[model samples]
Every structure is written in structure tokens, then in C-alpha cells.
Target: MKSLGVIVEYNPFHNGHKFHLEQSKITTGADVVIAVMSGQFLQRGEPALVSKWTRTKMALLNGIDIVVELPYAFATQKAEIFASGSISILSSLHCDTVCFGSEQGNIHDFERTLAIMDSKKEEYDLRVQSYSQEGYSFPKASSMAFTEITKNDRVLDLTQPNNILGYHYVKSIGEQNSPMKAFTIERTSAGYHDPDFNTTTIASATSIRRALFNHGGQIENVQQYVPEGTYQSLAHYQRQAGGFHRWEDYFPFLKYRILCSTPSELAEIYEVEEGLEHRLQQTMKESHSFDEFMTRLKTKRYTWTRLQRMCTHLLTNTKKEMMQRITSTKKSEYIRLLGMSKKGQSYLKQVKKDTDIPLLSKVTAMESNMLNMDIRATCTYAMKFPEPARSEWMGLEYSKPPIRYNEETNTFI
Candidate 1:
């Protein structure tokens, strides 16, 4: 069975995501759709709006046949590392193609851009380093370098969020020498970072999240932008977990973590570089909330996303050495199954014989540095919840089986 792979957060699995899944299937002409989703923390350094299990159910209820957890090591990193891990998983699964929604929408442009970068690799690296030394954020430096090197409008635009990710996806595919073909569909209606509801049905996830958080966690506020399953999942998660996950929910704990840790200790955390430890320790004392802390911490050298990711690392006590050891290898050590439909089960059966990586359904007795990081991240994310819910959710890493979705009954078994 041919499979098409997608890298997703599905933070609430809105209407635009459903459209992407549909178009990916049609474009790839694959028999099954596999989504590699972030676990507790997303790429942008924020906690997921809901748990991975809840998001897995949302994917299964939508058109996705299989949902696999993107390990924390890769899920929280920058674009290049994120794309590398995602493409590696898809390649390991023997997916025929990987599809992404992008502003450019054309695959050739990405190919052209990659060729240009390859040709000007040394110069590009030099410029990026120079700009970084001058206090520009890495993404900005890279964008500026690309513009200077390429100077052609025909190549993919690295400034657009989706296009930047898409470019890295294509680059990873080439670097890994994977068999999977790459495809992109034009994102409809909403921009990736647009924080306002500009469309009736196809609003960005950012906008939907903003609405939900602003409107007292009311699912009805963003109901028009997401599917019925997503709406139900959000409502159910809110009721059961007491509230949707957000940075603000854990700000107090983060503040405590920073204040108690010594500068040297904070410096050991991943992404905490060049005296940022002292800044974090000093600013966290005066800031009462996550928003306030971020406002105080923001600088031209560090993007808000970068600082948030750094804070996430600090909150989880993820040391730089630990991340380096985990990410030393090019591919993930295992494929963690989160949920699957009947078709997905059949596909798994077919692929398991030749699969190179271990396909894990449960965490019991599993011992690996990468998997341990995922479990640790789960624990950190669960701590913000109250009472029984906190312990119950954290224990899920050990006890919860891969959710089996019954397509016929439209329910998880």
C-alpha cells in the first residue's frame, strides 16, 4: 500500500488542515495518509493546545489513516532538524511521497532554490554567520543570505513560514537521499502566522488559537474554522483537562525554574547561549506572566520563537549535552505509534516486515535516550494540570496503548 506522509502539529486540527490532507492524498495518489505530529511541545516552543492522544483522535476522525508522534528531540528544534526527523520517519515507513502546504505551492521552485543554495553553500554560510554575529536572528540572517545569493524571483521564497519549512523539507529529502517524492499545495485563505480571523471557514490555526484563548476557552468561538471532530476534541479536552494547554498556564513554574537555577546551570540548557542565562534569571524575577516575560526577553538577536524554545528547554531541564547526544544521529531510533485506523493497521502489517526502525506501540520497558526525552516532555507538560488529572495524564506515557480507531463505527477501540 502506498502511503503519503505529512508533518503536522494539528494543534486543534482545523478546516485548513483537513483541506491539506485531502489535497495531499489526491496529489500523491497514495492508499494511506500518515501524519507525524508533535507530542507535547510544538515547533514554535509552545505547549500543544491539547494532548497528543486527543490530537491523534482528531486526525483519525478526519482523513488521516495513521498518526505517529514526532519525538521531542526533533519536534522542538529549528526547521532543518524538524524536517530531517520528519522526512526520516516517512522514509523509514516507505512512504511514496511527502506533502506540505506552502505559499509557493510549486515543487520546482523548491528544487531550484535548493540547487542555488548548494551551488553557493560556502558563501551562504559565511553570510549567515556574519549576520548572526551582528545580532540578527538565524532565520533573518538566512533569509537575507538567500536573497543575496539567489537574486532570482523564480526560486522559492524563504521568508514565508510555510515556504521556509517546505524548503527545508525538500533539502532534507535530498540530504537523506530518501525515495519519497516531495509535493506542496497552496495554503488556502489564511497565512501561517496570521493571528486574526480573516476568513469564515479557512482561518489559520494561529487565529483559531487566539480566538479560543481570548474568548474564555469557548470552543464555539472557533467552531466555524475547524471540523466537527476538532470542535468535539477541543471541547472534550477543555472539560477533562480543565483547560487548553498554553505557555501562560505554566509561567509560574517556569519562573520558579529560572529563579532557582544558577546562571551556570541555565547555561547548560539547550538553546541558552552567550549569557542568556543571566538575562533569563534577571527578567523572570520581574515578570509575572509568560507574555510579560517574553516582552522583557525579546531582542533583535533572539526571536520570540527561539526564546520560547529556550524557555521550554529550561522548563523541562533539557541539557544541551543531552540534546546533542540524542540528535547526534540523523534518524530517530524508533517510530512511536499514537493512533491508527483499520487501513493504517493493515498498512503497518504490510510495512513491518521490511521496516528498518522499531515501530513502538507502548513505552513499557522501552529504554532509549530519545524515547526518554519524549516521556520527560510528557511529564513536564502534564504537571500544569490539577490533581488526579496531572498524575493520570503523565502516567499515560507508560500505560496508554496506541489508539485503535474503528472506521466502521467511527470510534476508538
Candidate 2:
């Protein structure tokens, strides 16, 4: 069976995701779809609206064949590292093609952009550094550098979120020399960061999440934007977890983490740089909430996303050394199986022996540093819950098996 890959968070699988999943299969002509999903923390350095297990079930119910966890070390990083980790899993799984939704839907445009960037690599790097030194955030500086290198209307608009991710997906595929081909489909309806519900069905996850939170965790608010399964899952997760996750939910813990640590200690956490430790310590004292802290902490050198990621690392106690050891290898140490449909199980059984990396179905006895980091992230994420739920959720890291979806019954086994 031909397998296609997608990188996803499924923050709560919604209508837009359903559309992308359906289109990806049709566009790639693949029999099975594999998703590399983020764990407790997402690429943007925010806790997922629901746990990975909840999101995995959502993916399996919504038509994803297999769902694999993107290790925390990579899942919460910037676009390039995130893409590299995602593509690595798909490559190990032997996916024939990977499809992503992007503003620049045409595949050739990404190829052209990659070519231009490659040809002017050194110049682009210098320009990016120069712009960064001039006080621009890395993303903004990179965009400025791209503009300096090419006025070609044919290449990707790097400023767009989905397009930036897509570019890195394609870049990683080439860098890793994977045989998997890349494909893109134009994003429909809402924009990546659209904060309000502007459409009836196809809305960005951001909008759906905003609505959910705005409405006090009411599933009905986002029912129209997500599939029935997703809506049900959201409702179920809220009932089970007591509330949906948001930055506000974890602010107290994060604030405590910030307040207790010395500046030198904070400096060791991943992404804390250039005296950010001192700023985080000082600003956190004056601020009581995540929003207030971020408002005070925002600077020309740091994007909101970048700062959030740094905070996530701080909260999880993820040190730069831990991240550097994992990233320096530039490969995923394991393919963590989160869930799989019957078709997906069949595909995995057929490919497991031939896969280049270990396929981890259980976390117990795992010795890899990367896997240890993932466990720590899970534990930290679980800390947000109250008493029994906290222990129960934390235990899931060691005990929860890969969720098996029985397609014939349309329920998880």
C-alpha cells in the first residue's frame, strides 16, 4: 500500500483538517495516511487544547491511518527543526509522498524558492544576520533577506505561516535525501492566524480555539467549524479533563517556575538567550498572568511565538544541552506510535521490520535521551491537571498503548 504523510497538531481536529486529509489522499493517490503529530506541546510552544492521546483518537476517527508522536525536542521548536523531525518520521515509515496545506499551493513554486535560496545561501545568511543585528526577529529578518535575494513572483511568500512550514518540509526532504515526494494543496477559507470565525465550516484552528476559549469551553461554539467526531471528542475531553488547556491555565505554574529560578539557571533552558533570563526573571515579578508577562516581555528581537517557545522550555525544564544533544544528531531516535486504524496497523506490520528506526509502542524501559525528554514533557503537561487526573494522565506516558481504531466498528478498540 502506498503511504502518504502529513505533519499535524490536530489541536482539535476540525473541518479544515478533514478537508486537508481527504484532499491529501486524493492528491497523493495513497492508500494509507500517516500523521506525525505534536505531543503535549505544539510547534508554537503552546500546550495543545487537548492531550496527544485525545488528539490521536480524533485523528484516527477522522480518517488518519496512523498517528505518530513528534518528539517534544523537535515538536516545539521553530519551523525548520519541526519540519526536520516530522519529515524524518515519515521517511522512516517509508511514506511515498508528503502533502501540506500552504498559501502557495503549487509544488513547483516551493521548488523554485528552494533553488533560489540554495543558490544564494551564503548571501541570504549574511543578510539575515545583518537584519537580525538591526533588531528584527529571525522570521522577519529572514523574510527581509528573501526579499533582497529575489523579486520573482514565482516563489513562495515566506511571510505566510503555512508556506514557511511547507518550504521547510521540502527543504528537509532534500536535506535528508529522502525518497518521499512533497505536495501542496492551497489552504481553503481561513488564514493560518485568523483569530475569529469568518466562515461557516472551514475555519483555522486558531479561530476555533479562540471561539472555544471565548465561549468558556463550549463545544457548541466550534461545532460548525469541526467535524462531528471532533466536536464529540472536544466535549469528551473537556468532561474528562475538567477544562480545555490554554496558556492561562498554566500561568501560575510557569510563573512559579520563573520566580524560583535564578537568572543563571533560567539561562540554561532551551531558547533562553542574550540576557532573556534576566528579562524573564524581572518581567515575571511585575506580571501576574501569562498575557501580562508576555506583553511586558515582547521585544523587537523576539517574536511572540519565539518567546512562547522559550517559556515552554522553561516550564518543562528542557535545558539547551538536552535539546542540543538530540538536534545535533539531526535524526529522530524513534517513531512513537500513538494510534492506528486497522489499515494503519496492517501497513505498520508489513513495514515494521524494514523501518530504519525503532517503532515505539510503549514508553517503559526506553533508554534514549530523546524519549526521556518526551516523558518529561508529558509529565510537565500532566501537572496542570488536578489530583487523580494528574496522576492518571501522567501514568498514561508509561501505560497507554497505541490506540487501535476498528474501522469496521468505527470506534477505538
How would you encode candidate 1's per-residue C-alpha lDDT over 1-413 as one tens digit per residue? Answer: 88999999998899999999898889889899999999999999999999999999999999899999999999999999999899999999999999999999899989988888898899999999999888899989998888987885468778899998999999999998998899999998999999999988999989999998898988898989999999988888888888888999889889889998889989999999989999998898888889999999999989999999998998888999989988877688899999999999999999988888899999865689899889999999998888887898899999999999999899889
TM-score of each prediction: 0.99, 0.99
Against the true structure, candidate 2 reaches a TM-score of: 0.99
Which RMSD values do the candidates have, in order?
Answer: 0.9, 0.9
Clashes of 1: 0
Q: Clashing residue pairs, candidate 1?
A: none
lDDT of each: 0.91, 0.91
317-349: candidate 2 lDDT, tens digit per residue? 999998998898667999999999999999999
Model 1 scores worst on lDDT over the 10 consecutive residues at 149-158
Flag regions of model 1 displaced more than 4 Å: none
